[model samples]
Target chain A: MSTWNMITFQDSNSLYSDNLISFHDFIMLFIIMIISLTLFFIVDLMLNKFMNLLLLKNHMIEIIWTLIPMFILMMICYPSLKILYFIDEMFNPYFSIKAIGHQWYWSYEYPEFNNYEINCYMNNYMNKNQFRLLETDNRLIIPFKISLRLLVSSVDVIHSWTIQSLGIKVDAVPGRINQLNLFSIRPGLFFGQCSEICGINHSFMPIMLESTSYFNFINWMNNNNN
Target chain B: MVKYTQLGNATTLETPADLKPKTAPYDPRFPNQNQTRYCYTSYLDFHRCKKRHSEEYEACKYFKKVYTAMCPLAWTTNWDEQIENGNFPGDI
Candidate 1:
């Protein structure tokens, strides 16, 4: 899959994920790789005797190299810390959903809405139009452009609830509740799978979410109650 | 005089290997008496069969039988209701 294209991260659906990708591209394209390539070229020129470096033993060069690396590290660290805090930061969400991981399936609960829940299982034999193992019987529905909190845990072994496009990965460990915030930028279907190696049928656990408009979400809620 | 004997012989000493007993493979036709495992596996199989033969319910009769036999009636009924109402039962 990586070879077909560069296997770039999926087109991000959330602002947080988009920011993360942009930061990644900035570091790789502008800072790290660019500097590394420039250094390599300089080294190559030095080796070819095209560029003479007579200040090899100079204290100024030593100080400059050490200070420059420190400066570069600090630059990288600032944004890294900001993003980490941004991800951890939680706001008042419209609703919360609890996801409990089983051995080979996932169970989602909407606690705010009268204990509404659903078990999502992978569709083993998919139709020609559906993704092979990505399709699930039930989708975790959320409204677009709204802050939603997800509480993750496990009933059996450890399972990681990962949604690559949304840049959310929380380990679903037994007796431990992990929380993450989700804000969908648009209405669409996103697919993910249980990242943790759970059991014999671990690969069968797939996660699918359908983001809808606020009005449609209310309609869905009303429909479910009836 | 004490008889002197070699305490450790590299060739004579045999190390015991760490061994684990192999488990039997799961058989849908003759499932184990454990209802939990049997029902869970049957539930998966039922869905798998249903997905594979969407147009033909007769083809998945074996899975349906296994699931129906293994899973409790209450659980099956609840799940059937949930499916009917577009709500998936969280428990099998």
Candidate 2:
């Protein structure tokens, strides 16, 4: 049995979770920036009081504030650009799934598995027992500990496929395909909703992904086909 | 295995609040199944839903069939309940 660690951001059963070094790096940089900005503000406040004294007549505080922010911005920009490029670079994937977005629903296709396809649409009118907008007829099932490539596209309008737990979010454009690298850590259910406002029913486009062991995943794929 | 949501009593299913509305097709007064005539030029809204006319239904049916063949298990709809609820099958 695997122990669950909430302190870590690593997903339950994934390989690309290790590749998420850039996101963490940017987060650390962001924290440093906040601290630097806070200190700069404090120093500016002190210097403002000090400058009130006619004896010390220098434009030093203004220069420091301008230069410090520029330095901080440069620091933030470099890592931000690097992370964007790294995420865009597509590595060889173990498996791929094509996700299609409609007005208020999502459809998925596994081309490699005899074109096994699944349509997962949210049921808005959940009878007394069902989850509203968050419930779908079919859930996306993937294996833990494998690199999965997601190809996202839309049929009608633009939408965003986002699943924070897996740290995956990609845009679904009408005529173009957007690719995303996703991998999950463990065998459990995780949920997310459409990040973009596509239509009135946009809120109804909920996503449910379940990660399982490689063997169990294979069994699921087979069962789905049968 | 599928279940509906229970009300505050936690034992009864919450029926739709509007037991019947003006849009209810079950009302015999408007049995012709009235729908708005939507012009393509005027229909560019976010939730713009296109309704095919009788003549266009043939082409729409072909497209639906092709789509279903492309993705079999995903296209089927529950017809009986949908009909009772005044919802069109394969509308999307």
Candidate 3:
């Protein structure tokens, strides 16, 4: 994320993040409507001089108010639940990568290729174009346009594997492996960090993923293997 | 190891039919977000399955695959050492 997206969500790189952003906008529309409607009512209460002398309570208004909220809730519930299930749907993965979290670094492994490992530590030295704390020594390279699986675990303490652009966040808990689906729509560099604080250097354990084509990924694998 | 033929000549990659990566199937017994019990139980079940049947038994290999995918290599490596020493906590 650059300075532009620091206050908001980063540029979406997957369908999950796109759906999440739309859902956020959908909820925000209701929030703004509710606030404005309440403001109008408050203004009406303060300025109105007319009073209904014969009316104690109106049944029509009460029913309308109750049913309107129910309708609105149903509208919100449908898409919210749909996106939740959609994100959880794990398609057949083209590649499966395992990520193990340690005290201040994240080590990744390609389980298919004889456990090809890449230990990613924080990169203190950075160029002007790179992010300061978000840079890492190794980037977890993946193939875009193909659905992949990410298995997350912690070696010692609990950590969180997160990438906001893809809307993927899985808790790296010790003694267990949690999996997530990863499908980037485009080729780019996505950055994240260990959201769950394991120790003092938890802030230093950053994650960087470089998305490329499948052909390039295979070449990278061959080169690393050799 | 899985390899692709489109190394340098082709722009697109066609994965072979047998290149699908496999992971542990979901078990309903441990149906929570945390999978610690799932990994531990799978490890115990694999050893127990080995004790009941031969190592080459097809069904015994299923539990081994689950434990291998879900648990860290260090845990299984140490557990193998304990099994050789006959100091493993859980009964086979």
Q: State the fraction of real interface contacts model 3 keeps.
A: 0.16
Could you tell me the lDDT of residue B22 within candidate 3? 65
How far is A164's C-alpha from truth in model 2 (Å)? 0.9
Q: Which residue pairs come into collision in candidate 1?
A: none
Ranking by DockQ: 3, 2, 1
Please estimate how well model 2 matches the true structure, expressed as its whole-model Cα lDDT.
0.57
Tens-digit lDDT track of model 3 for A82-180: 777667666656656778999989998886666688999988854787788999988999988877767789889999999989988999988777877
Q: Write the per-residue lDDT of candidate 1 for residues A1-226, one digit (tens) a residue.
A: 0123656888788756766776676567547675798999888877884544664677887899799878777776677677676676654445667788988899887755555778999986837977888889999998787777676777779998988888888888875556677777789989888999998988899899999987798799889978
Q: Write down the lDDT of every candidate, Cα atoms only.
A: 0.68, 0.57, 0.79
Report lDDT (Cα) of residue B40, candidate 3.
77
Count of backbone clashes, every candidate in sequence: 0, 18, 0
Off by over 4 Å in 1: A1-6, A30-56, B1-92
Backbone clashes in model 3: 0
The C-alpha RMSD in Å for every predicted model, in order, reads 21.7, 17.8, 7.3
True-contact fraction for model 1? 0.00
